[model samples]
Structure formats: C-alpha cells, structure tokens
Target: MKLIFALITGLVFGTGIAISGMMDPAKVLNFFDLAGTWDPSLAFVMGGALVITFFGYRLAWKRDAPLFGGCFQVPTGTDIDMKLVGGSALFGIGWGIAGFCPGAAIPALGTGRWEVALFLVAVVAGFYVRRLLSPAGSAKAAR
Candidate 1:
C-alpha cells in the first residue's frame, strides 16, 4: 500500500514537472537568468507547489499516522552546520551549471536524453562520494 501510494504520488509529481516545462533545461536556465530574459513560469510552478504543500502538511499533521505508514517521518535536524552549508552550495552550483535539480532531472530522464543520463550518473556518484567521506556514525545513520 505504501509503495502504491508512493508510486502514484511520484507519477503525479513527474507529470506536474513535465507540464510545467521543468524538464526543459533551457526553460530552467531562463528562470535563473535574472539580468537577461528571465522566465517567470518556474516561479508560478513553485508557487502552486508551495500552496499545495502548505495545505497538505496542515491536513497530514491532523492525522495520527500516515494512511499507509506507522508514523509520520519528519526531519528532526534543525541546526545549520558546515556540512549542510557545503551540500547546499554544491547543489546550487550543480543546478545552475546543469539547469536541473534532482527532482527535475529524474523526470527529464523519460525524454531519453543523453545529458539527463549523464547528470543522473553524476548524481549517483556524488551520493557514493558523500557516503564514503561521511563520518562512520553519520554514514550508518544515513542507512
């Protein structure tokens, strides 16, 4: 049931990404081009997602547990540390250079683009690199 729900949710999210032109690297790059031909479409897409998430969180918290989960699994970490800052910087740099974040890239793969495939390969490699460099305890915690 949980897997089913997750698949359905992912499909909906991917569809939204596709419809919003997020799968297009040029469109995404245009959104980031502040001093040039900046496209505001991504902002609208983000606003819509934010609105949905705001209401969804409110409703989800009202339930004792998720519909198919034992309990709500929310992030407990709230502190800002060097690792967090570094990872965020890396993510932003990668997105700016490639014009595709992880979520957007995953759906873009369906287009059968070689660039997307390379980006995903790099993403997976980054994950392994992070795991290898993390502290022993932190690596175990991730698992």
Candidate 2:
C-alpha cells in the first residue's frame, strides 16, 4: 500500500512538473537567464512552494511523533557553517548552469532526455569528489 501511494505521489509530482512547463529545458534555462530572454514565472511557483513548506514544517513539528512513525527521525545539526553555505552555493551553481534540479531530472530521465543523463553524470562525479575530499565518512559516521 505504501509503495502504491509512493508511486501515485511520484506520478502526481511529475504531472505537476509537466503542467508547469518545468520539464522543458528551455523554460528552466530561460528563468535563470538574467541577461538573455528571461522568464520570471518560476518565481511564483517557488514562492508558493516556500509558503506551503513553511507552514508544513511548523505543523509537522507540533506533533510529538509522526503519525506514520513511532518517532520522528530528524537531523540534529543546527549550525549553519561555511560547509553548509558552500555546499548550497555549489548546488545552486550546478542548477543554474544545467537548468535541471534533482527532482525534475528523474522525471526527465523517464522521458529519455539526454540532458538528464548528463545531469546524472555530474551528480555522480560530485558524489565521488565529496567522498575523496571530505574528512567525515558517510552521513552515518556519527551514528
């Protein structure tokens, strides 16, 4: 049942991306192109998402435990240090350059887009680079 729900959720998400013209590389690239033919439409989509997520997080935290789980599995890292900032900048740079984010890229891959393969290659390269450079091992090192 959970798997079925997950599949349904993914389908809905992909459909939304398609309907929003987010699946098109041109549309996404246009949004990032400040000097060229710029599209500011994605701002409304991003704003709506941010507003919804803000309230969703607040509501979720009001519950002592998640309804689907005995306890919530949350991250304990509270410090917004240089590493976090740098990583976020790197992610944003990649997104701005490629016009493809991880979420939309998967659905794009399903459509057999070559750009998705290119994005995945970059993602894998980043993973290996992080592994080689980071002092910490995997994310579970603390655990």
- TM-score of every candidate relative to the true structure: 0.90, 0.79
Find the candidate with the highest TM-score and give its number. 1
* C-alpha lDDT score of every prediction, in listed order: 0.87, 0.79
lDDT of 1 by residue, 1-143 (tens): 77888999999999999999888889999999999989989999999999999998999999998887688877788889887798789888888898988899899888898999999999888888877886463544331
Best by lDDT: 1
- Clash pairs for candidate 1: none
lDDT of 2 by residue, 1-143 (tens): 66787799799888877667677778888998999999987887778768987999889989998655578776788888887798889889888888888777878888887878988888888777887787476465332
Q: After superposition, how far is residue 118 of candidate 1 from its true place, in Å?
A: 1.1
Model 2 TM-score relative to the real fold: 0.79
Residue 137 accuracy (lDDT) in model 2 = 60
lDDT of 1 at 50: 97
